[model samples]
Target: MPTITLSVKDENFAGKVLQEVLIGFHSETVTIRDIIEARVLQEVEAYNQKQPQYFNGLVQPADAEKTVNGYQLRNKVVIDPEKQVYVALDAFQKNGFFVLVDTLQCSSLNDKVRLHADTRISFIKLTPLVGG
Candidate 1:
């Protein structure tokens, strides 16, 4: 089983780690969409088992006025993991976030990339300006 590390980044490169999951790939490559899906599912499972303090993914901060660190929801909101993943994916399609595979930027969701034993995948969330 190979493992991939997820890291979240803002404007700065000093990113915070989101999670790590062991994924089984049929071949030496996998699609960007599949990678995102796996990452989201892992996050959802973690949230369901033991609710984390924060969620750093492709989401609009405006959805809830109150939040922790402007990413994690402040209120104890019940989230449908599948729905959240879909929302994130949709957002990605619209340039909501960016995916970097081992320091290389991935522009297309269907793009195939080779995997490594410890691949470092980073997600950079783009925040919209207020009243812009």
Candidate 2:
């Protein structure tokens, strides 16, 4: 059994990384859903420990106010990882954002993603332009 380390990054259309984290998985092959869950869980765990006012996660938590960099909660509280994961999966299905597995765009949550140590996964969130 070997652990594969993948670089998960959040980037914009211009190819700038907003946040980056290295995640490890033992399975060589996983579904897009697995990747999303892992990323969200990791972020939530970190936030829970600190109970920060700002949450920099894959998906915005319910009741959070979206800020320029991340979401700002009304008060510091432990975030629910399950809820965030559910919201993220729904967002992916609704085209709220997109996942890129080393240049290949993921189409479905069940899409099989092959893992490699050097794999670069990028998540680009789509924001509707104001009054466009």
lDDT of each: 0.61, 0.82
User: In every candidate, how many clashes are there?
Assistant: 0, 0
lDDT of 1 by residue, 1-132 (tens): 544433433433466654334445555688888877776665556555765566543443234342544345556465566776677677778877788878888989898988876566677766431110
CA RMSD for every model? 5.0, 4.1
Worst 10-residue lDDT window, candidate 1: 57-66
Residue 107, candidate 2: Cα error in Å is 0.0
- lDDT score, residue 84, model 1? 66
Per-residue lDDT of candidate 2, residues 16-119 (tens digit) = 99999877777989999999888888888998899777888887777678888678887777787888888888888889889999999999999998897778
TM-score of each: 0.67, 0.90
Question: In TM-score terms, which candidate is top?
Answer: 2
Error of 2 at 55 (Å): 0.5
What clash pairs does model 2 have?
Answer: none
For model 2, the stretches where C-alpha displacement exceeds 4 angstroms are 128-132
Q: Candidate 2: worst 10 consecutive residues by lDDT?
A: 123-132
